[model samples]
Target chain A: MLDFLSEFPSLGRRDLSALRQWIDEGFRTFSRAYGEQLEAFFNPLLRFLVWFQDLLTDAPWPLVILAIAALTWFGARSWKITGGTIVAFLLIGIFDMWEDTMATLAMISVATVLCIAIGIPLGILMARWDRAQSVITPILDVMQTIPSFVYLIPVVMLLGIGKVPGLLAVCIYAIPPIVRLTNLGIRLVDREVMEAAEAFGASYRQKLWGVQIPLALPNIFAGVNQTIMMALSMVVIASMIGVQGLGVPVLRAISNQYLALGLMNGLAIVALAIIFDRVSQTYGKRLQAYRETGRD
Target chain B: MTEEEPKVRIKSLYKIFGDTPKVALSHVQAGMSKSELLEQKGHVLGLRDINLDIPGRKIQVIMGLSGSGKSTLIRHLNRLIEPTSGEIWVDGEDVLAMNDKALRDLRRFRMSMVFQKFGLLPHRTVQENVEYGLGIQDVDQGEAAERAKKWIDRVGLAGFEGHYPGQLSGGMQQRVGLARALATDAEILLMDEAFSALDPLIRTDMQTILLELQEELHKTIIFITHDLDEALRIGDRIAILRDGEIIQASDPQDILMNPADAYITDFIKDVNRAKVVRMRSIMGPAAPAQGAPVAVSDTIEEALQKLHAAPDGCCPVMAGDEIRGTVGIDAAIQALKAPAAAGAHYS
Candidate 1:
């Protein structure tokens, strides 16, 4: 593949060596920086996360299982989803990956929260300003296309290794969809609504928070939903940094040729994605419904 | 004319669109017409030296064709689009000089607008949409809700409190739009062809609603429309605008009877004089005491109704129960038969 790529008329040897050198330099820099600064504080962040993970264990397996079942029941507005939710978790328990699954869930929850925090405001800004949109759109395009493995280097330099850095990497990889979708949602709000707000003596701020943001919620939620799925996909790549969970099992399995372990971990990921996806999509639809009916 | 001064005043208002507006407009003022201004430079003078004085509580309608600057004129009242060179005073306050706070305060407290496309907040319920203006001023939730409910009820949207705009028909949405503006209690209402977007039947319904509201409140209104029928129906004082100038402004009766210019005459030509024109104005001599006579105040619709019920299409249009002139069977028949037949001889 490398030889085929190099055969391109524009290709050159110096470019390849320079790329190799850059990759080598980035890895060493990250290794040194992360070990020195993150070795202590990173441990506590992980412990705090793991402590939060332990708090979930306090709910008891049956209650936790029932909550998931309840979610799917109310969420899809269908009993079929409720049955599927129960079965998916059953598969995780059968595979003996419940604890690791919970850890992955905690990391995902945190990253998803961060994505919403960052993405919605960016989307709002982009919607309101043409110059801001012109500046942000190309960058978002690059962020979405850049591979998950490629992001770990800079994230490790900026925040360094372990839970925080891994989480940051996941955020970078996942947040673009939310921002783009949010911008799309807000831009799609009818021109009349904005004009109405203005004519009603609404300040710009009032129009934004009161009209634009609420109207754009469904699109933002879809973006958030996609972001969660992206974050989950990045979880395995993030684990290659000193982060751990179901991703660790998958990484270990991949390295040691443990097919059963890899297969089981991958199945756990699929289950988790389904569970989160159905729930998020259900809420997104609910918001659209509420917007239509003007109900709470 | 009133003992109290006019509520709104504009003097020599000109809105020129260009980077070098002053330069472009200066050339035009030096004896060049608007077309010449556009030709000499890439400058289009949207509004040119318009002067108007709107009396308090008057429903003054500005009628014009599309691209004739009626929309632009209405927008200027609220500073939605600032005039290029002009002064507008609202309630003795210099509108052009107001800071952002003052302008916004004026909008929230004293003025509001109804756009043609309802412009309802799609994400809000009809009730919440009405509450939006109050919310902008940070009114308490209870007060806003109460006011919104009152206005919504007034506009006859009481049961539709929770319905979004998409669920409502074009006319219903316009009712919500009118309610939203009225809820603000702004003394001046600027309507930019407020009912123009609806079907003819629905448009009539909205115009009826507007008439009822005006009867009750009598807020100073600035209405813009291209439809002359609508313009005549609602305007207490009609201002015929042509290419940014008010060609004729007078009581509707006066304008219908005697238009100010040849352009205005041409515009009013199709407006059946028999319908809007009084028999007293069109008829010259009183009828001898033998033939039937139509009433002086009889609208052409009523005259036609009478004619339709009579043995022949003719109805002697009477003034004050006295025969002014015999509108012979031939005349009524001609009016009924062809569009061109009526009003030409009268004019």
Candidate 2:
């Protein structure tokens, strides 16, 4: 077809040989320009994430448990959270799995905090603009639905294995719940209430800060709580990326077919999960109740 | 519109909410009334071009059934909803022409609103809700607190300042809302059925509070309500609206005694017009003064009670302690007898 077109009067001198040559050269340059590096770009990051994981597994279990106990005591300021924290403290201390438990808690904390810090602002931006919401919502969905292992592959490729990379992957895996919830919360402010603020001479910023955002606090807190739980869930998966803590020991015990080690580390992870869940849930409940009481 | 000038001069204001408000407005300016422009653009004509002159320091009720544009009209005064076209000369300045900041300043400083649902901030306590606007105005905490305390007490919520709105009854919530609007101390008050959310008894209680507040402060008020009884009971001048147009804007007695059309007549028909219409409607013109004078505010029931106790079978309608007219004893009795005979349910 190319040779026939070249012979036609209207066709401007099409040449198959030259075209083939151009295609070959273009393919060569394209491969040269865009081919993957032999060295995994994520190796350093993956290594760092694994170090983070190791820190979790290698840290003194007693110290890790004590830190969590202190955190809940300060934040919740209630007997229930304090009691739960103590139970978490004793469970690790008594089971003689204190080191692994501490490691798990550390990993989960970093993952959850990072998730929240990024998630909340993104949610606020989505709430503030429909275009941003449309663009970001699909990305959040992708983050939420894709298998956890997919995250590790890319992290390992770009940054190498580490505690940081796993934590980063864990955050990416868990943050959507918070962002989606935050956006929904802000959007759900009563239309009449918004109108009242405007009628009362409140500026756009005033309405957002004074009325809409404040009303949305309970919902946003719920999102944050959900994020915490999700981040906790991702801790185990993240351990695959060289994350330390209970996951590392469990994985080690599993690979070596040491049933007792696996069971003990798993139990320690469960304890950490319960502590994280209770504290986050209690704080979120406190926020909701305070709002109701204040409004009432 | 007078040279002496009223506080708010709303002339041919229009608010059509749909598709390209700017484009709709430009089309309206090309020689079309609000409804015509709305029809031309196939938009919901929320507010027809309404020209109203609200006087300073008077309680003017904008009465209408649902979807009658009473709320829409009042909302325009504060620019909570901007008018598509037409001029709102607020104290001789075109309100629609004010820039964003100036308009907000106007709304915050000069016009404040109370909603039917008691639009208190749900995250705030009664005290905070009352202080919300004051805070927005940059009033110092102490002063805002002081002002909030004063109005909260004035609205008879003296002990409930610390309580949240959800803890308060519907009436108390409305009171908090009123106190919030009052705390702002804005001269123009736009009340969109502020008392309607309360039960009947609580509504009456809030009504009395509002009457007292108006009497004391004499703030110019634009009150919107679908309840005709509320309008007749509270309004200094009532504008009867139907289908986004004012049918009549007159004194309550004028609206009750001589309603504008069949619709308004039906609206006032079931109302015990005799009870709502004062003795002035039944009384003879100024008679020779002989005894103590009854103020125009005295109700027929009150008049009946006062006349029954009096030896004389007559009561004089008094203004500033002078007899303006005489409501005869026979006339009073007949006025009393007629409603009772009509199964009017005057009570």
lDDT for position A136 in model 1:
98
Alpha carbon deviation, residue B270, candidate 2 (Å): 1.6
**Per-residue lDDT of candidate 1, residues A47-164 (tens digit):** 6776877766566878888977887777777677788888888788777998888878889887888799999899889999999999999998888887767777666765666788
Task: Chain B TM-score per candidate, please.
Answer: 0.83, 0.85
| TM-score of chain A in every predicted structure | 0.81, 0.74
The digit string of per-residue lDDT tens for model 2 on A156-249 reads: 6554566666777878888999899889988999887888888778877898889877888878887877887787777667778877667777
Give residue A162's lDDT in candidate 1 (0 to 100).
Answer: 74
- Cα lDDT tens digits, model 2, B7-74, are 78888776777888767756655656656765677766666668788888888999898888888888
Q: Model 2 off-target regions past 4 Å?
A: A1-67, A94-96, A290-296, B1-3, B20-42, B282-284, B287-294, B304-316, B326-347
Off by over 4 Å in 1: A1-48, A57-59, A70-77, A290-296, B1-3, B31-40, B279-347
Model 2: fraction of native contacts: 0.69
